[model samples]
Structures are given as structure tokens and as C-alpha cells.
Target chain A: MSTATQTMPSVERVVTPGKYTFGRIMPEALKYFIVITLAISYAFPLYWMISSALKDDPQVYRIPPVLVPNPAHWENFINAWKSDNFTLYTFNSVFRYAVPYTLFTLLSSSVVAYGFSRIRWPGRDKLFYLCIGTMLIPYTVTMVPLFIIFKHLRWVGTYLPMIVPALFGNAFFIFMLRQFFMTLPEELSEAARIDGASELGIFFRIILPLAKPALAVVALFAFMGTWNDYLGPLIYINKYTMYPLALGIQKLRAMMSQVGNAPLAYPYLMAVSTIAAAPIIIIFFFAQRTFIEGIALTGLKG
Target chain B: MAVATAKKWRLSKRETQNLITGLLFVSPWLLGFLLWTLYPLISSAYYSFTRYDLVRPPIWIGLDNFREIFTDDPRFWTVVYNTFYYVGISVPLGVVVAFLMASLLNTKLVLRSTFRAIFYIPSIVPAVCSAMVWLFIYNNQYGVINNLLRAAGQPIIPFLSSVEWAKPSLIVISLWAQGTAVVIFLAALQDVPRSLYEAATVDGANALHRFWHITIPMCSPIILYNLVMSLIGAFQTFLMPYLLTNGGPMASTEFYAMNLYRQAFEFFRMGKACALAWIMAIVVAILTAILFRTSGRWVFYGGGER
Candidate 1:
């Protein structure tokens, strides 16, 4: 039902071009022309990013800009990584965010989803509706007070402000996982229950193993949300040492421009930007199917 | 009380055990609801009425914060106007562009998945990277676009540096990151059954007719969903403008969320920020309700009770 990225050949692909007439041919030709043009245009910005990142300082400033760097300054990536201590920042993104956030969000959300979906206790549906209602509460409404709460906890500069939230499940992720959990036949879990298995055991042994794709959707989304989060860190973290990649990349730019006594180090900044974006890109390519299906599932089901 | 009502509250021993187990599994969310969700939601509303800076205890001034923003703040009005302007142009334009992109993608194009990926990659790229890339592209003098214009002996436009151009420049940046909407629309577009199109074609209906009558009716529900989500997202837009322009060029790009961020963080006007936050919440709620209410007219559910 959720083969959202299935690209079957449509009727038009096999159209017999019987006697090419102006009326018949123009629309098809025009359609292909428009599609190709848009595809290239969509891709040009990233191409520009990569090409500019490879160029040296001077080449970046040259008029009628270089499309591809002649001698690729591969060292710029190393320099950018070392510059402003991006090594620390990258590690911060991994340790402070991606790993813990994904794991906790998955663990908490899936268990909550199981409770909401599989359990037949009274008040479950009402509580589930209450949980979904929280999705409508704008982040703005919570942002100020959350900051206040974190500040009171003296967690303003710590990873806890960001990371700890994942320990409690998100409403949307719970909703998505619950939808997946509900689809499993009641008899499977019932059969487990009759065999003297606990609910948690049934969830761990039977439910979780089958919920990999949905869990991946929640996990990857959680990782990306943390990896790309700027405002939360921007508000809480003032010390440059604790900054994640998203916020640290800004510091990298400032540090580069100042160290060279130049206005802005365009190529180096682009290089850092490229490095910052690399992990998500690699992940996207590797789990291309899961990523597309996840998006399609959320979009359609949502 | 009736015996039925009393009995309903009382569960059998086994049923009570099941309830206890269910609550155990969901206790994390329940605890979060009280601390993170419920507490903040209430306090935020409460704080919107007071004059609180973190150092000092919150001094209550009922409705004064709201009054100050409404009656006195010119900057607040400007922020609202800038936000509406951005939303007005960007959201609808995004919908159209994404719909077009999706429709084109739904066609029998070569390298279709590659094209879809290309279209989608920009949206998934971190806002920091995408914003900085545009900063390079939109840089006034040394930026690529201006450089090209200079090389061609054409006039160079100040993109992010001019009042007239900054918001539009930000809007352009938003359009780049609208691939999520495109994917959503593409899914909806693909879901439109071929048989309906075939039936329409046999009836002598053209592409425009089928799109208007069939493709549209079938996809209207998804469109509304995407619209509401994008509207909420666009209303709270912060990262791009914050990173790219930093609400500069005479603060033409200071959107609602950015203004709220500054108020809370820069000025330490926590009370005022909460007021702004509440105002945003109300506006969003109203706007969403309006959309859902008015959606009955245009949002055709091919399935009944849609």
C-alpha cells in the first residue's frame, strides 16, 4: 500500500509515434524540453557549491566565476575541518545529537506507539487523541518556557537542552509509528500473550523486528532534525566549544574571515558548508529507498 | 449516580491490571506532558501577561504586554507585515511550483528518479548550508550572479543588501527548499488513478480538463494538508533569514519568528516574547481553522466525508 516511490512506466512512455504531425509532436517535445530544463536548473546550485568549494581563494573572486576548479584545492576541506575546530563540532553533532536523539526517540516513541496501538485498555484512544493535540501547539508557545526551564536546570550550555527531549516521544513520530503498529494483525500479539509472553516481550521480539522501515523513518528524521537544529543551540549555547555543526559552521566562517584579515573567505566557507552537508547526503544516497518511502508515507498518510 | 455509571468507573481485577500495564508503557509521555508540554503551555500564557527578565522575578502587568505590542510597537507591525508578505508570496508560489514539479515528475520522463532526487536534495540539505550557498549566489558585488551581470555589462542587483530585494531574496531561498512539498504533491499526483485519466481521455477531455476535474478533485485533500503544513512552517520561518541576511538591509527581512527570537534572546524581553508567541499561536489557530472551514468548498474528497 505504501510503495510511494514505485515508478512504473506510464501509458505515455510507450506511445506509438505513428505519423509525426505538428499538433501531435509539439506538446510531447515541449513537455520533455521543459522537464529537462527544470531538472538541470534544480541541480545547478549544488553543482555550483561543489565547484566553488574546490577553487582557491582568488579563483572564487574571479569575474565570470570558475565552473570547475582547475587544480582542485582538496586541502580546503582539511583546512575547513581544522578551522574553528570543526573536528569538535562534527563530533558534537554525532555524539550530542544524531546517536542519542535517534536512539531515544525511536525507543520511547515506538514503545508509546505500541501502548497506544496494541493495548486495549480504557482511556487509550482518548489519551492518544490528547497526544496528537499537542502537535497543534506551536513551538513558539513552548520555546520561551523551555528555555526558562533549561536555564533553571543550568542546562543552557549543555547537550541536555536538546538531547534530553528525545527521551520523551514526539507526538508526530508516535502517531506515525502507531499507524504502523495498528496494521499488524491482532492475532499475532494475542498468540504471543496466550503463550505467556509479556507485552514488552511481544513488542521487542515480534513488533520491533517488523517495524524497521517505520522506525528508520522516525530515526533518520530525528537524526536530521538534531543535526540541522540551529535555533535551539543558538539560544542555549554561547560557548563556541559546545556548538554543533549547524551553529559551528557560522563560527567557522567568522574565524576564517578574521584569521586571514580578509572580509570573507568564500571558498573556505563553501568548503565547510560542503563538509557540513556531506553526512546527510551520504545517508540519503545509501538509504535512498527508505528515505523516499518515508517521505511518501508521511506525506500521504499525514 | 446510576448503577451503570458507577460500574463503568469500576473495572474487573484483570482489566485493572491491563490498565496498569498500559499506563506503565505510556508513563514517559504522561510525565513529559505534565513537565514539558502542559507546564510550558500554561506558563507561556501566564508569562505573556507579566514583565519578566530572567534575573528579576516576573512582575505581573495584565494585558500591558499585549497593549504595548498592539498600541505602541511599530517594529511589531513591520514584522507582521514582513511575515505576511513573505507568506503571501512564498506559500502559494511554492504550492504552484511544487504542483508543477510533481506533475512533470509524474510524467514518463527519462531518469525520473534521478530528476526527483535532484529536485529533492536542496530541501534536505541543512538550512545553514543552503542559506550560505545562497549568500554566495546573492552576494552583491563579488557574488556569482553579480559577477555574471558585470561580465555581461548588465546592471548588477543588490540581492540581500537592498530593502526592496532582501525579502524577495529570502523567498527565493525558500522556493529552493520546497522539495518536501513537491514530493508530497508528487505522491498525491501519482495516486491519481490512470483509469480516471483514461476515462476522461475517451470522453474527449483535454489535459487541462482532466487536471481541473479529475486530477484536482482527487488530490485536493492532499493539497489542503500540504497547504496548512506549509503555512504553519512559513509562519515560523527563522533559520534561513537568520543565517543568510540576519534580518538586515534595514531589517526588511525580520520575520515574525526572527523578531520573536530577538525579543527573547537579544532584548531579554521574555514577557514580550511570550506575548508575541501567544499572538502567533492565536493567529495560527485562527488561520488554520479558517482554512479547514473554507476548505469544504474547494477541497474535494474523492472519498465521501473527506
Candidate 2:
């Protein structure tokens, strides 16, 4: 067909399907049109959120729905922060919770994955299968019992329940890191072993450095997991003083919606949401592959 | 997962040392499985048969908790029905929306990555933030959707405030976060062989025909995967209803997890909550089993190896 078209352009024009021109272009155009509509609808809530955060409370409810705030009350962000302990929440989410959890999960899951992947031992396969099976157990099933156990240990009002689990590693991260470890050639570690590098030395000096990208993936996921986690904080953190951003934002709304606070603080609510969401949004933009790969890896669901 | 064996599975001296080292490395998982997973799982099940509060020891009560849940609690049934209603409509609808978005995304479009990023960014947003934004979006007097309706002279619909509209409204919120499934489906769509579509087109298949024939069948495994994941996630929908609706407007949005939270924490019906948890677990397991069993009929693996 290419040769014929090259030989005689006019014949090729005549042979081309006539019915597909308008039909094809219309669908192509319509496809994009539908895509734009879908994208707008998907993006509108987030856009509405940030835009409304810029609006005065009254402007949020204005007729015709302000697409952009003329004044752009940028102070709403700070006002929302000061209206509640959102700064405390932010600190808890990042410094207290997400950072520690990410570091611990990266180290713990990597160590476990190294065991499952690079080492040969009896009962290893069974244990790896057990790790996979643990993923199937829903969190709700454990919620009741874990709460009881934690309460017994007087951990209900503390961050221990949430943070302690990370030191043990997540099954999903373990499975993910193990898959990454399997792809590395055994020779890398074997050569290190031949050089009298201890097993821990090889893991720390060779494997960990080589697995930096996967570690970043795991670390980002671990951070986001706790950063976005609501149930964990809701269960463990009793005092409003200790609530992470996820739970704290909800409390901010509730406090703002209390009696005598007429004309709901829509701007404050959106402002809090935007503040809570900013880290995730920034992370998504910077490490988009982390989100994409994390989703694909956990596609089968836990 | 295979490991080369030495001396017909008997460990040599070096192998024994490796075993100790490997066990040390995996001790976190070993301890977690026992303390975190196995112990809690068994205790949770055990607690279901006992009437216990935080202050009191768990008193053995046999299947009375289960019996009450089945025969006495009317709200429990409502919660179950609400969960099924949400899961039934939300899961299938989520898959459709995700597939539609993914299919649209899979096409040749300029600025594709920006659009893909736009579509996917929502799924990563914290659930509480998503809930807060949707709460404001569904505000009857000022919500964007309601505002649009008002501008067009239509009566404003109370979203989270109405019984009839609340569950559907929450479902819409759920559909917003289907970006995970959307990206997954997009990846799967990219993997689908283009030659299959070309072959279908040569045989006079139109766009819809090619879609139903080539796309659906080719993407069946991914469709099944998204279906399962969406179902599980939907069944556990909590944070949205809790934050936005608080399972209000007549408990219309009181999903499984929300009710479980209420029983265990708010009411301190720990035994009853444990029972609810076990019941949900069994239902989820049964549903997942049924899905996988029936999947063989619909899910088409590439290379045709069943």
C-alpha cells in the first residue's frame, strides 16, 4: 500500500476511504471534547476548592459562582491555620508521623524483602506467601482487636499504635520491594561476599544503594500512606491536640460549623483542605511515577 | 520463589548461618504476623463471641452477638442494605467511569500527561481533604453543582442533607477518587495489542464494535481486577460519609466501616463491633471468592492460558 501510494498519489487519493473523513474527524474532535468535559468535571472540585479558598466567605456563595476571586484572599490560608491548630496538625503529619513511618517502612520492608529475595533458607517461601496472605486481611478485622490490645497497653491516647506498626513493615511494601530485589543480579551481592563483605555490609553498602530508586518509591508511598491516613489517627489519637492533618482538618470543619457560627466558614474549610492537600499535590507533581507505580503495584488490592 | 536446595533439603553449616541471618532480617515480619496479624485476627474472632467493654473482661456469650445482629438489630440491616446499595452501584459505576476515562486518555491527544495527571491527582489526595472539598461542593445553598442548578432555574437539591440524595451523593464522591482505577486501566489499555484492533477494523468493525469486541475482551482481566479492587474499597467506604454526611439523613450513608467505628468506639459495643467486623469479613471473602470463581468466564488472559 505504501509503495502504491508512493508510485501514484492520485490513485492513492481515489482509493482512500471517503466515508471516514468527516466521520473520523468528528469522532476525533468529539473524543477530545468528551475528554475535556471529563477532565473538567474531574478537576473542578479541586479547582473549586483552591479558588473558593481565595474567596471571602460571602463570595463563596455568590450567584453565578465566582470562578476567580477578585480580591484573592490569600490570607485565608494563614487565617485557617490560626483558626485552629492546623500548624500542629501539619507538623504531626510530616515530622511526627509520615517521616518516621517512611524511614522505618523503607528500612524494615527492605530488610524483610532482602531476606525473602536474596537469601536462601528453609521456610522462606512459606513466609513470603504468608506475607502475601496478610495483605488479604482487611484492616477492619484487626481494628477492633488491635484497639483492645493497644488500649490494654494504654496506647489509645498516644501515637504508638500508628507508629509501632510501621517498624514492622507493610505487606504491600514488602512485596513491592521484594519484586524490586528479585530483578537485581545475584552477582552484585556475590562479588561483595567474595570480597569478605558481611551480609549486613553487602545490604547496607551495595544493595541499599543500588535499590535507591525503589527505596524512594517505597519511602514516598510510606509517607503518603500515613500522611493520608485518617482511620489510624481517628482510632489512636484521642486528643484534638495530637490529631494529624487528616483528622485535624475534619475537626477544623466541625469547630467552624458549631452553633452561633452563622454562615458556614466555606473559605476556612476549603483553606484547611487545600493546606492538608498541598503536600500530596506537591508530591504527586514531583513524584508522579510513585503514585502511578504504587497504584499499579497494588492494583489487585490488599 | 524457588530456592536451590543443598543435600536434599538438609542444611549445611554455611546454609545454617544464612538461615539465621535471613531469619534475623525477616524477624520484623515474623513478629508482626504473630502479634499484629494472627493474634489480633484470632482475638477479634474470639471477642465476637464475648460481651466485652473496655472496662470489663470479655464475658463468654456464645453466638448471642451474631444472633442479635441477625434477629434484633434493624439498623444493622439498614447498614447492610446501604453498603450493598453503595457497593452494587458504586463499584460497577466506578469501573465504567475509570474505563471511560482511561480509554479517552489512551487515545492520541496533545498535552496527554497534563490531562492524565489531572485525572489521577485526586486519588492521592488525603481522603479527609477530598471529603472536606466535597462537603463544600455538596452544600445545598452554595455548592457548585447546586449553584449550577439554581442558575438554570432548577430547584436546589440537598446533597448530603437529603436521605434520598445522600448515598448517591457519596457515590459521586467515590467516583471522583476512581483515578487509581483509571490509571490502572490506562496502563492495561496501553498493553492491549493494537493488531487486534486492526484485525477487527479490517473485518468491518466500527468504533463501538471494535470497542465491545477487541477492547472489552482484551481488557477483561484488568476490568476484573479493577472490579475486585473497587468492590473491596467501596465496601469499606468510611471517611467520606463520616466527614460529609456522618451517615446521616436517616443513616443512608452509614457504611460498614462507619457502623463498625460507631459500635466499637462511640457505643463501646466491642463485642457487637467484633461481630460486625467478622460478618463483613465473611461477606467480603465470599464476594471475592465468587468474583474469582466467576472471573474465569469473563476474564480473558492474554495468550489464552486459563
Best by DockQ: 1
TM-score of each: 0.95, 0.92
Top candidate, metric TM-score = 1
Per-residue lDDT value at B121 in model 2: 86
Q: Model 1 lDDT vs. the true structure? A: 0.85
Model 2, residue A69: distance off in Å is: 1.4
Off by over 4 Å in 1: A1-17, A257-264, B1-15, B304-306
Candidate 2 chain A: worst 10 consecutive residues by lDDT? A5-14
The CAPRI quality class of candidate 1 comes to medium
TM-score (chain B) for candidate 1 is: 0.94
lDDT of 1 at B23: 91
First chain TM-score in every candidate? 0.91, 0.89
Top candidate when judged by lDDT against the true structure: 1
